[model samples]
Target: MSTSTAPDAKTVRQVRPALRAGRFSTVLRVPALVTIAVMVALLLVLFALDIAIGDFRIPIGRVLDVLGGGGTRAQRFVILDSRLPRALTAVVVGAALGLAGAITQSILHNPLASPDLLGITAGASVGAVAVIVGAGGGAATGTLALVGVPLAALAAGLATALAIYLMAWGKNTAGGSGVMAFRLVLVGIGVNAALMAVVSWLITRASLPDASMAQHWLTGSLNKADWSTLIPAAVGLGVTLLVAAASARTLAALRFGADTTRMLGVKIQTQQGILLATAVMASALATAAVGPLAFVGLAAPQIARRLLRTPGEPVIASALVGAIAVLGADLVSRTMFPIDLPVGVVTAAVGGPFLIYLLVRTNRKATL
Candidate 1:
């Protein structure tokens, strides 16, 4: 056997790439754990801030006391009845939207792929609007109508998603390959436009009071949040979160390439369907609970990925980021502004510019 010696310059050069990759890999190893911890802590702090900064402006200490069930009756009402449920709704809705966005973007390998853009939210709006307009809007107040609103949204959103999928199916439906990303997005845009027009027509047909209520729901607000809203949001978010977490590995693998995923023995089409359905469910549930908040699903996942700098989808991070984004937007709408704007409006204001920037960058790159 030949004795080994210190490597020469040529050998060292050849081995440098492996060494570099190994070093780079370690940066994400420990820091990834730290990043997740930081995110959780930050989310808790933000949640507290949201509770503390409302009209009465409870101190953080008092907020904690109220949460712990030691505050006065008025404080209790404000915290438990008013603020707590709304805060919880914001957190869950944000998380669901973020998770949905991450899954959609990852599956389609498109930054712009989100439930809102795909017209899933519009479909929810259509369902909710139909119920409201059909029921005579403000006159439709009953326990049944409350229950029906969310059910209608879920059904309509799912149907809308099914239609988009079928329309975008193309020849890829036969195999394990997923729908083409661009084609899916394009079809989604068209469907969204058509659905929006239907929503407009429904609003126009309703009485003034009903139209106003329908408009409020369409704008998306947490002002109406109560136990009723919280229940469905919680159940939906919990179920979808589990499904997404369990299938995260398969979803992440698909990010590499279809050929790589197939070679690794993943059923690409089935996996895609599972992930897409989970995303749709998450989006529909959030919309059902608090109306459709624009851009949370679009912006949250991208923000989380940028923060984590991970090759895989930052599923947990996305959820946290989403919760933070909605809560932050709501806080601003409540406090910083003269009037309480719909949380969806704030999100749209932020997301609209970001979307434009993304489009511009994408176009420039394609042109180059």
Candidate 2:
């Protein structure tokens, strides 16, 4: 064997990336772990920012005191009523989107699928729009914005999922996952357009006040969020998360293939129903709270997957990534504009181009 001189520092540095990457592969992929950990840190920072940076600055000291123990009534009120509600809403909504994105993509086995493109968000919008325009007027706009149309959104999400499944199932009667996916996407496109039409009709019928309320809701803001909206959304999300964690194995299995699922003796039909139902409920509740933020659900999970490069949907990872994305967007929205922009508007602006990029990417991958 030929003896070589000692490797220089530059050569060692050059080899470090591949070596570290290899070592990382032996572990559970550090990027996913880092992303999640960073998200948690960012979440904490965002909460502090929310507390300290609003119009009435409480000072970080008082904010902590308000969170922990004794503070004056005014400080308590600011923390409890203002910053707390907004922070909580952001966290809850983020978690819901993350979970919703994971389940949607897992069940459908399509990285590109999301409520935005899949029309679940649209369906929720239709429901919320109906309530905003058709039901209670100005007096109840706040409550109606979050609650009145929530059921309608839930119903629409479920109905749309059922339609896709039934239509896709019928088409795949003889065989083929490829055809099922294609036709289901095609159907989603049609449903999305149709739902937009319904929303338009409702907007026209809305009184000026109602229409303005609906407009605000449609753009998807968390500015007016309060405790009244938080409880129901919390309940919806809490219940759904337990169900998702319990069903992860089956959900993961589904990503491989339906036939693999069948072979593994997983009740593909029943499990799928559970996954889709949980997705619908969580998504509807989040949408109702946040006003049909169509794109986050679509964009978040894909970003998580690309970042992590995990074998399957990486459900927990996706959820954390989503929480970060939404909260980060909200933080920027609040600070970036002279007036605090709505979270939904910010998400749509960021997520829209990401959607187009995904479509192009999918096309390229399909061709490859």
lDDT of 1 by residue, 237-321 (tens): 8988899878867887889777788898898878888888878888887898888898899888888887878765588888998
> Which pairs in model 2 have colliding backbones?
none
Ten residues in a row with the worst lDDT in model 1? 14-23
Candidate 2 lDDT, 250-360, residue by residue in tens: 887888776777899898778877887788788888887878775777777787777777766677767776777777778888888999888888888888898889889
Q: How many angstroms is residue 188 displaced in model 2 relative to the true structure, after the best TM-score fit?
A: 1.2
**CA shift of 130, model 2, Å:** 1.1
Q: TM-score for all predictions?
A: 0.90, 0.87
Alpha-carbon error at 22 in model 1, in Å? 24
Q: How does candidate 2 score on lDDT? A: 0.77
In model 1, the clashing pairs are: none
